[model samples]
Target: MIHKLLTREQIEKGYIRFLEKNPLALMKVNNRSQQIEIILGKKLSNIQYIETANILVEYAETIGIDSFEYLLLYAVESVEERQKIILLRDELTKHDYSVNKYTGNA
Candidate 1:
C-alpha cells in the first residue's frame, strides 16, 4: 500500500483533473540528462517536485504502482523506497524502452 495525500474521491477525480489541466506536469519526470543539464547546467536537486502536482505524479508513473504510491514523496518518505521504485523503472526500461509504457512519463 502507498501513503496518500488525498482521499479516494480525491485520487479518482483529482488525478484526472490534474492531468487535464496541467499536461506539462505529466512531462517533467525525466529531465536528468537533457533539459535540466542544458538549462540549469547541473542538477540543482532531485526531480522531486517541478510543477503542479509533479512529485505525486512522478510517484504514480512507477512500476507496479497502486493508487497512492507517489504521494508518499514526503518529508517522512523513505529514500530507500524511492530508490527501489527507480530501480524497478530502470529494469522495466531495459526490457521495453518506451517512454509511453508509463502514462505519467508521456
Candidate 2:
C-alpha cells in the first residue's frame, strides 16, 4: 500500500517512469493511445481531454487493490468518477479473501 498521498504531477511522473521501464504495458492497450500521448505532452494526436479512468480500472484489476484508492485520488479529476472508484476499491478490499461464484439463480 502507498503510505503517503502523491500529487497529480508526482503520480503522472511516476507513471511515465513506469512506462519507460515497462514499455510493453502501454503498447498492449492500443485502443486509447491518444490518452497516453496527451499525458506525455507530445503532439502525436489531437484528441479530447484525457482522463485516467481507463488506466485506473485496468491497474486496479490487474495490479493490486491496495493502491486503487491512491491511484484514483491522484489520477482521477472528476468527482463522480472518483466516487465510483472509491466504492469499487472498498468492495474489492472487503472481499479480498472470498472467491465464491454464482452457480445460478437460487
Candidate 3:
C-alpha cells in the first residue's frame, strides 16, 4: 500500500484547478442586480451539490461545493479564505466520520 501526503498549497491548488474545470452545470446571471445564482438543478444545499461530482467534494469540504458559492457565502476571494475553507472541510469530514463510520454516503 502507498499513501502520498499532500501539502496545503497542493490541496489549495487542486481546488483552484477543479474550479477552473467548470463543473457547474448552470448559473443564472442577474444583470440588473449584478448577481449570479447557482442552478443547483435539483440538489438542495451546497453539500448536495457534491453529488454531481463526488470526486470534487474535498475541494468544497472546507467551504461549500465550489469556489463561486464559497465566494458568495464567505464574501471573500483570497488564499486566506481558501485556507479557512480547507480547515472547515476537514473538521466537517472528521465529525461526519466519527458519527457515521459505516454506511457513509461516500
Task: Return the clash pairs for model 1, or none.
Answer: 59-70
lDDT of 1 by residue, 6-72 (tens): 3454444544455455456445534443466577676533332243245455556755563344443
Give, for candidate 3, the lowest lDDT window spanning 10 residues: 28-37
Local distance difference test, each candidate: 0.47, 0.51, 0.42
Q: What's the TM-score of every candidate structure?
A: 0.26, 0.35, 0.29
Q: Model 2, range 3-22, lDDT digits (tens) per residue?
A: 23345565675455444444
Highest-TM-score candidate: 2
TM-score-wise, the better of 2 and 3 is: 2
Error of 1 at 43 (Å): 36
Task: Report the CA-based lDDT of candidate 3 relative to the real structure.
Answer: 0.42
**Candidate 1 least-lDDT 10 residues:** 1-10
Q: What shift in Å separates residue 102 of candidate 3 from its native position after superposition?
A: 7.7
Q: Which stretches of candidate 2 lie over 4 Å from their true place?
A: 1-4, 29-31, 34-53, 69-106
In model 3, where do residues sit more than 4 Å from their true spots?
1-76, 102-106
- Could you tell which candidate, 1 or 3, scores higher by lDDT? 1
